[model samples]
Every structure is written in structure tokens, then in C-alpha cells.
Target chain A: MSGSRLSRRTFQRLAAGTALAAPFVRGAHAAGKISIGFWDHWVPGANKATTDLCNEWAAKEKVEVQIDYITSQGNKNRLTIAAEAQARAGHDIMAMPSWEPHDKAKLMEPLDDLMEPLIKANGAVNPTVEYLGKADGHWLVVPATAGSQIKGPCSRIDLLKEHAGVDIQALYPAGSPPKADAWTMDAYLKAAQACHKAGFPFGVGVGGTPDSVDTAGAIFSAFGAVLVDAKGNITVKSDTVRQALDYYKQLMAVLPPDVPAWDDASNNKWLISGKGAAIMNPPSAWAVAKRDAPKIAEQLWTHGAPIGPKGRFAPFVPYFWGVWNFGRNKSAAKSLLLHLSQASAAEKMVAASGGYDLPAFEKLTLFKTWVEEGPPKGTLYHYPNPYNHQVLSMAGAPAPPKIAVQIYTQAIMTKMAVRHFQGEAMEKTLAWAASELEGFMRT
Target chain B: MADIAVSRAGTVNGAGGRTSLHRLMQRKSTVAFLMALPLITVIVLLVVYPAIYSLHLATLNKSMERFVGFGNFTFLFGRETFWLVVKQSCIFAITAVVFKALIGFVVAHFVHNIPSKGQRKWRGMLLVPWVIPPAMSTLAWLWLFDPSYSAFNWILALFGIDPVPWTGDAYWARFSVILVNIWIGAPFFMIMYLAALKSVPEQLYEAAAIDGATWWQRIWYVTLPMMRNIIAITTLFSLIVTFANFDIVRVLTAGGPLDHTHVFATWAFRVGIEGGDIPLGASVSLFMVPILAVAAWFILRDITKRGNEA
Candidate 1:
């Protein structure tokens, strides 16, 4: 009987076989497959987090899952979405960036059923997320936990202290209440001028890229400038819009002379190269600085945006996970999305992204990676809008999704400022914007 | 006579008479059509269908559900950006093509003058810009034109010159986009001109030289006359490609600085793909056909006429 007992090597073999068979055993319950197209993460280790989450969900759901991390570089993701919609085929699940959900709302499966339970469990999503993710009465997408970046001021603490004599830490301390009420647009202009004169201007872009558009949107939102309202009416020829344009024109004067041609990476490069004292971007730039330029990293602080006439508003670009209505495995796709949206999984994703990912849910913002990991120990603490000092918004918000999407993607606000800066009469610029909006509305 | 009789008997027995199908199979035109069937199918499927579909799309409303009947075109005519785009596309294509031709011609002459042995090396090196992908090369240009940390600015500072706003100001952005296009495209022209220059008979040049023709006169009379077909054909081809160019403008300026640098293709992309108005975008792109067709007709007609004369 003792001799017949299993040997140690045999027991080890048995354990290995069981481990390999676990997924197949689960597959016996539901035999199916699903493919997902995810946006390639800019931060290192973020993709692995998503892959692991998806694999785990697949095993538990007994479905084979294939994930493709597609890059957003050069608008390839948008092209893929467009092509899939046109052909009525592609991955069952896809990651849609800000404005994309609204752009492809017709082709997306309504996610209201999946999102309602999530809202109850995790609290309501940010209003900006709702503005872009929901169209009519249906939730067009599930707000994703990856690549949701907030464009806030990542200023050089040392330079701002030296040149502008403003201690950003005192104004928006990492662990303390924000005393940043005095940080108004007027102060921002002054700081920009001072920085430029001191030979380190702010690296704010006005180009057609999303980075530039988002910043311009925040500034416009702060001024309560609604180029197009929710009813699809052209509101460009207004006093608030004029004020926003005038302010942007003046602000552009003090920034880099070539700000108008900058793409999304320009400001990142500008900051990493130590040429700009501040840039409105996500922590990705700071993360790069930490690796490539440690000295600059230590002096960097991510804080709230400056206040405007309306209020303080920061540019927020959120990611959404939407399933195509033409997808074959709609049930499996929704299940995977729900699995990834769990609070535990969201935290892991945020941590893996080095605090780059911001969960749409309020509860997941308390991930430890935001506080514990940094050169300044808490540099990204306020990155998630913890202090409530700034209203997070995206480009062309507060308008009808159809019209706002056009205004945002076409970069009407940035162009308005550029036209004004180049000596176009305010009235002419307003008329031009009004006519463009009118065209959009008609379309 | 006996062989003809035997062939006639074989043809009759083949289909119990000479059937129309058997007769057509032996025809030259039928054989040629059969040979061209694959190519014709590809052309229809890939090119003709897409173009017809695009035109059809242009007549639809935004949601692509209703027939609008030239509404998009009329709407575009009313917009200021559309006019700017049309003007900019023309200037961008014309200026870029003209410069590419001139630069290519000069460089080809220079290469021709070189010892034949070393010409290969120079040609190889000069063709490097054309060989590299436009998107990748544009990245290098973007870095060089960075406003804050531009290598050009560093070089300028070293000399006592202010940094040029390579892509910042509206005019400068136009110049920068045109410059990058020329840099990338001139090499293609150079290669074509080089091939054309090689084909020009050396005897004509020697005769012009013997007849007391100066360098400039010889080129004007001999080289120009000989390479006229190649030059016109290349120019037309380059014009079409340049007019429809999207990658360079999309990468460099993205039609920015108040839409001062937008060309038709980029604008169409912005309006169609990004703006979510596919019908409007299709209409904007359809505007390119008329201009390209005119250019192609004139140049190609000349080539056919000259070919018939030869």
C-alpha cells in the first residue's frame, strides 16, 4: 500500500495538469470567443495590467479572449473604428477615446444595462464622461479605467517660485486643502509673461491636436464661452467667447512663438528638454522627466489649473470601452467590460499605469500609487482632481454631442484664438466661427 | 491545298460544323480580352467602384440616410474654410511640384556630369530622403522645428539670427510644409530625371556642342527637347500625387495655425473621419477630381501626340 502511494514527482505532475486544465474545465460551461481592440497605453506596464485582467475574466467566463492593443498615434484608432463601422465587422470590444463614443454612437451597442449596476456600486461617473459616453438615452460606452488623462498644469516648482514668486505647493498642497482661489487667469497670464521674459515660457500648444484642443476647451469653459449650445445653436458671436479669445490671444503672445504648430508630443518634449517652465499635460510627461531628467522631476508639481471668470476648469480626456453593435459575442464582451471595471481591477490598472490611468468612478481614485510613488512623494496626489478646486471637462463640452464633437475635433476654439492673434478682427473671427458652427449644425 | 482541306475537315468535325463559340475562341480580340480580364476586374473592384460609391456618398445627408442632392457642395461653397482649403491646396501642390521639378532637373544634370562610376553612389545617397517613409522623415522635421528646443533655433542663436517660426506663423507654416514636401518629393523627381537624362542620346549634345552652342543653349535646345515627354509626364504624375498628399501635411502642420496650412486631403479627413460627417468629407474630396483630370488630359494628350509623330 505504501509503495502504491503516489510519489512526489507524480503528485507534481498531477498539480501541473490541473493548472493547465482549469481554463478548459471552466470553458465547459460557456464555449465561446471574443476579440477586443484596446487602445495601446502610453505608460509602461499598463498594457500588461489590462491583458491580465482580460485573461482572468476570460478564464472565469469560460470564453477565449483575444486582445489587440491598438495605438492612437496618427488617428489610427479612429480610422480602425471607421473602417469597422463601414464594413460592419471588427473586434467585439473596442476602446474609444474622448469624442469617439459620440462620433460612433450609432454603431455602438447601448451599454445602459451594463453601466447602471456599475453606477450603483461605484458611484456616478464624472459628468464629462457622461457628456461624451452617453448619447440620447443610451450609454454608448463603458467609461474605461485606462488612458483617462487630465490635462493640468505640471509646473516647475523651482522656476515658478523663482520667477513668478508663487509657491504652487502652498497654493495646492498635496495633502492639504487647496488655497488656490487667487490663481486666476490674470495671474496665469502674468506668470506666462514673466516666465517667457525669464527665458522659460509655458509650453501650451494651440495646434489641432487633442492636447491643444483640450486646453483651449478648458479655457473657454472657464470663461463660460459656449460656441455652440446644447440645442445645436451657434453661440460664437457672444461676449464671453470674445473675452476667451482675447485672453487666449494675449496668453499666446507670452508662450512659445511656435505654439500654433505644436502636436501632442511638442509640450512633452518641451518639458523633458527643460525648455518650458510649465506645460498643461497629464503626468506622462512628468513620468518621462523622472526617467530621463531626474533633477527636473524633483522640481515638478502637478496641480490645479488657473481660475477663469466662470471657474477653474481642467482638460480631461477620458477613455471608454464600447462594444460594436455588429459584434458576434455581445454578451461575452459586456462581461469582460464589467470584470475590468471592478474596483479591485481598476486599482491594479491604475497602479500598473504608474498613476496614469484615472478611473471614471469616484471610489477608485484612492489608489495608493498616486500618493506613494513620486520624486516628491505626492506629486500626482492632486492629479485626480481630489481637491475639487477645478471642474474637469473635455473639448467642446456642454453642447450637443453631435455639434460639440465637430467643434472639438475641428479645433474651432483654437483657430478662433489663432485668427484673433494674427490680427483678424474679433467681429470677423466671431462671424467665421458662427458660420462654421452653423455648418456643423446643419450637417 | 491538302493541308487546308484537312484543317477545314478537322474544324467541321470539332463542333459538327464551325460553331460561333469555336470561331470566337480563335479570334485575336477574344484572346486579348481574356488575357486582360483579371486586370479589368481589379480596376473595377478597387478603383471604379470606390470612386462611384464616394460620389454617391457625397450626395447624401450627414447621417447617410437621406438623399440631399448637392447640399454638401453648396454648403461647402458657403463656408470660408472650404475656400481657404481650395486655395491652399492649389498653392501647396503647384509650388511643391514646380520646385521639385527644378531641383530635380539641376541635380540630375549634376549627377550626369559626374563620372559614371561614382554616379551610383551619389544617386543612392540622394535617393535616401525619398526612400525613407514620409511619416518617419516628418518626425525628424517636427523635432527640428520645435518652438522651444529646436535644433534650428540653437544653430540660429549661434549665429546672431532670431529663430525662424518654421511652422508657427501662418505664412511660415505654409513655407515649412512646402519645404518638407519639396525635400521628400524632389528625390523622386531626381530619380526620374536621371533615368530620362540617361536615355537622351549623347550624339545630339555633341552635335550641339560642335555647332558652337553654349552650355545653356545646348540644354535649352537639346536636353529640353529630348526630355520634354518625360518632364511633362513626371510633372503631371507628381501634381496628382502632391494634390492628394495627406501624410506630410497631416504630420507637420495638421492644417493648423488657424487652418492656414490645410490642403484638400487633410481637410477632407478632418471633416469626414474626425468630424463624423462622412458625406461632407466625400464631397470635399470629390472636388479634387476635376483639377487632376484637366492636368492629366493635357499632359497625356501631348505624350500620345508626340508618340504618334515618332
Candidate 2:
């Protein structure tokens, strides 16, 4: 009892010793722990692949890894990022969507040293990835292997052939360069009209979501219609802009009247319900149909984006792996990110996603998963653009990040189309857009 | 002898009695303040602090670094969408609240007319919409409003009515959002009104009947006059909630059909959070304060007047 009831001096000495040894205690367990905020994958087994990869790396490095797969539904991922930024603490790494890496550059740890070796081994990253992941000569994020999808047209082969009289296989054959340069904006309009008349409309949205913005951006880019140019100039009143608007007006006439209210899920639902002949999206819709409606899934073919007047451009939404600057395990986070970016891991992710995942690296684009997936094998072979047939772009690109983010988030291009379709004068619509852009620039 | 006693007592007790009395008053005041400290702390921490912080946030630029007084507000004023959002918010809140009041009154009267034993069942059934979480119910509404496979359209098709765009056209989208708000909010109003109706003395209605007053007249004279306070309080509560509504509009239209159906909360979210302009978003949210304060002031004044009368 006397020994247990230590003197105050002895107690103080013991406390001092513990305090002195605390750093070493922490160092002993410095195998470290990391928490990652991952994007919730839509593909069936894609999340497992990511988890298994992380687990493999963790075992090898003797680090503890925590993964939280956050959903993009209702903009929850963005909300999580904002909440973490405001609180100055959260997951050590996060899977940032297309515009976020640039948006949160200051809060992120630079991954240049980790990415440089990966890039050298894997060839150059896609230019779109570089445009987003790098800002001010620093790599803000390492391009992620999962959930990086290219929102191109996924056409029902039977519906396209029977209604629109277009041969999907010939236009964009599997394991070959897409012969789709002749599939112009004019052809797209005619085909949409044909399909709509045949009671199968093209599923596209003009809502304030990524799916709508991406489609509208690709369409506008095809006509070389830059509302806000790269230099942050307002070009809404230009001739090309007028041409794009006019073309969109015609296309809108042939589309469903309810296109203005659709979200990212709407197009997927439209296609899976077998009411839409094609949708501008990645293969997730078809992947869902593969489970829910196998008959519809068998007929779906993922292919090249239709050519516009300017060129072919597909909307690519890439997820980037970013480490928080405030993270405790910076070394572990970077190392894990590098491990995930490897070609072996990328292939596993692509297979797990049923080719829904697109790797940003130039050499990793031709993963065998694309060649082997499906009821009709090789349906998604051309989804990944190994050749330079279509330019990989996004809604807010080519404009300065700040202004472009405004334009993209405001859903300006889609709104303009809706206004014109709803019987607004073209000149007035342009004026309204110009004024909105001016306001955004001012802010 | 009495004068001598009084003079002796006055000399003994004058300073000490006065000091004791003063200390007693001070002690009572201190006890009351200490008793209210928890509530004061809660208000200062939860409500007042956040309100002030949001005001501070509103004055900063997009990056939250530079102090740009009124810059965000000025930018919002210049925006055409901002004006549209203002108009839409006003229309949404006013239309939804009015309809909810009318519908709730009618439904409550219907429920009150039923037998007492059956009333509980009907009340429970009517309150199903209110009891369900808004997000879950909104998802059901979203599915029912789908352009292609809407259940409503399926029923309409059987009647040879062309599929009406429930959430597609701008006007219809506005109508849909308001309709959902009314549906979700009317039950609360109904229950409150029902309670007020029960509280009304049956003798008044009998007295009205004796005067040969019609059903409508009795409601207007006896029922309405008696329930005015409850009506005012419920309407004010619904107004505040409906104005700041986000889930219904966010899930249903997402300010779509060219942002035609956007309300204040959804637009603020789109601007501040999604658009990556926290300061501007904060400024947009702060716009709700004046309207809310005015409504609160009117309600509080009404309650105080009622209290004085009682």
C-alpha cells in the first residue's frame, strides 16, 4: 500500500520520464496509419479491387490503411471535401473529381516526386489529366485508376441499326481505330430525329450536373464555340457560338421534351429502361443493365463521340488521388498512391469495373478488360481512346480555372440551349449568357 | 416609555438592517442570473456565434483571404440568375405555405367531423407524409415524376391524357416543387389546427346554431376568431421552413430547366459549395436573415400581445 501510494516527487519524476519517451513510443509505431476518402465505384467489383490493392500495399509496408468510399450522389463527395477543408482535418488521401484538384490545390500535398517515376515508367499521362492534376508546375494529385470515366456515346447496336440505319460496328469497330470522323454534327441531328420518330429518343440532360455539362461542352467544342475562352474572354456573341446554338436548337427539337430536368442518373435510367437509343455516358449504364436487363445489355456498344464541326471531343471525368497537406502520414500516403498508380493495379481496377474505369496513362488505355468484356465481347474496346481520334476534354477546360469553374458549375451552356429551345430569341440568350459570364469574371 | 423604546431600537438596527436588506436583494438577483446561465450559454454558442461568423464569412472574397466588403453581394445583384432565384424563392414559399394552410384546414375539418373512435386512424394515415424523412419521400416523388416511366403518366395514359411533363417544363417544375412542399408540410398544420378546433368550446357552436348562423358563417365567426393565434403561429413556422427548404427542390429539379425552379437554399448551395465560392454562398445565405427576422418579429409581437391580453 505504501509503495502504491507514491510520493509527489516520485509521481512527478515518472510523468517526466513518460513525457520524454512519448516521441520514441510514437516512432516505434511509425509504420503509420492513413485514411483515404475514396470515390464510391458504380461498377460491381471495382471497390473490392481498390480495397484489395490498398490492403496488399499496407501488408507490405506494415502501415494501417483506412478507406472510406464516398458517393458522388447529391454532391456528397464535394461536401465531404469542403467540410474537411473547413475543419482542417479529415482523410489523409481523397479521390478528387475532375475540377477539385485544381480547386483545392492549396489544401493538397504536392505529389510530383511520387508521380514523376510513375509517369516515366508508364509513359506520359493523358494531356487532360495533366491539365487538371498539375497547376503552377506542381502535381496536386496523382491520377487515380478507378472511376475515371470517359462520357462518350453508348449506343444500342440494334436500335441504331434498325431506327437510325447507322452501323455501330462499322462506325467504331472493336480492336480497330474508330472510323467515325464522318459521323458529323449533321449526321447526329438526322440520326436523333430518325430515332425519335421511331420512338426511341437519345437520352441527354441539360440539368446542372456533370453529365449535362460534359455533353453540352463536347457539343459546343465540336462547333468551336467557346463561351468563355481560355484567356477568360467572353465569346458568347461570336458566329461559331451562334452556329452551335442553332445546331443545338435543331437537336433539341428531336430530343425528349423532358431533357432539361434529367440528372446523371436520368440518362442511365433512360438507357437501362430501353427507352433511349443512346446516351452520352460511360459504360456504367450498360454495366447496370447487364445486371438488371441482360437482353438490353447484350445489344449495347460503347463507341467514339460523334464528330462536331471543329473536331471530336469526349467529356472525360477523371478521379485524382490527392494527399492532404495536414495529413500525419505523408510518406505512407504518397507510397500507397504510387502503388495504386502502377499498371498492374490499373489493370485489376479496369477488369473489376468491367472496363468502366479508364486509366489516365497513355499506355494503360488498352487494358484487356476493354477487349474481353461483355455478352457480345469487345463492345467496350473502343471506349478508351488509344488513338487520337477524339480529344479528351471537359466542360470548364480551355478557360481559366476560376472562370471556367463558374461557367461549368452554373450550367451555362446547358441553360443557353434550354432557353433557346424554349423559344427565347437567340440574340437575347447570347446577351444573357454574356452578362452572366461578365458577372462571373467580375467575382 | 414607547418613545424611549423606539429610539433605542432605531439606534441599534439602522445601519445593520439596511445592509442586510440590500445584500438579500443582490443575492436574489445573482441566483436568478446563475440559473439562466446555461440557456444564455447555449444561445450565444449555437445561434448568435454562428450567425456572426456567417456574417463575417459573407464579406470575404471567394478564397476567404482578402476583405472585399459587399463584393459578393454586389456580384450577386448583377447576376440575372440571382434575380430569377429571388423571384422563384418568393413564389415557391408563398404558394406552398398558402396551399398548405388551406389544405390543412379542410383536411382537419373533415377529420373533426368523423366519429371520435375513427379519428385517430385517419389522423395517423394523413400524417404518413410528415412522419417519413424528407429525403426518402423525395426519392419516391422523383421516381413518380420520371419522364419516361412515371407512375402518374402511366395512369394518365390509361385516361388518354398525354404524358404531362411533371418536372420538365419550367412552370411545371415550379409547380411540382411547390406541390411536394405542400404535401410534406400540410400534416403539421392539420394536427395543429385539429388541436385548436378541439380546444374551442362546443357551447359557442351551439350558440351560433341558436342564432341561425350558416356553417360557413359559424366557421368564420367562431372557429376562425378562436384559432387566429394558432393559425398565425403555424403559418409563420411554415413560412420560415418553406423559405429555407433545400431537400425537395435539390432532389426534384436541382434548379434545373435552366435553374427555373431554384429557391434560396438550393441556389446558395450551388453557388457557395458546388461553385467553390464559399464567401458568395455565405452572402447568398445571409440574404435570408432580414426576411426571417421580420417574420420572427411579427410572430413574437403577436405572442406578446396575446400574453398581455390573457
Question: Judged by lDDT, which candidate is best?
Answer: 1
DockQ of each: 0.66, 0.57
- What TM-score do all the candidates reach, one by one? 0.91, 0.90
Clashes of each: 0, 0
Q: Which stretches of candidate 2 lie over 4 Å from their true place?
A: A1-29, B1-49, B306-310
Off by over 4 Å in 1: A1-29, B1-13, B16-45, B206-211
Interface RMSD of each: 1.4, 1.5
What are the fnat scores of the candidates, in the order listed?
Answer: 0.85, 0.76
- The sequence of per-residue lDDT tens digits that candidate 2 reaches over residues B193-252 is 999999999999999999999999999999998998999999999999999999999988
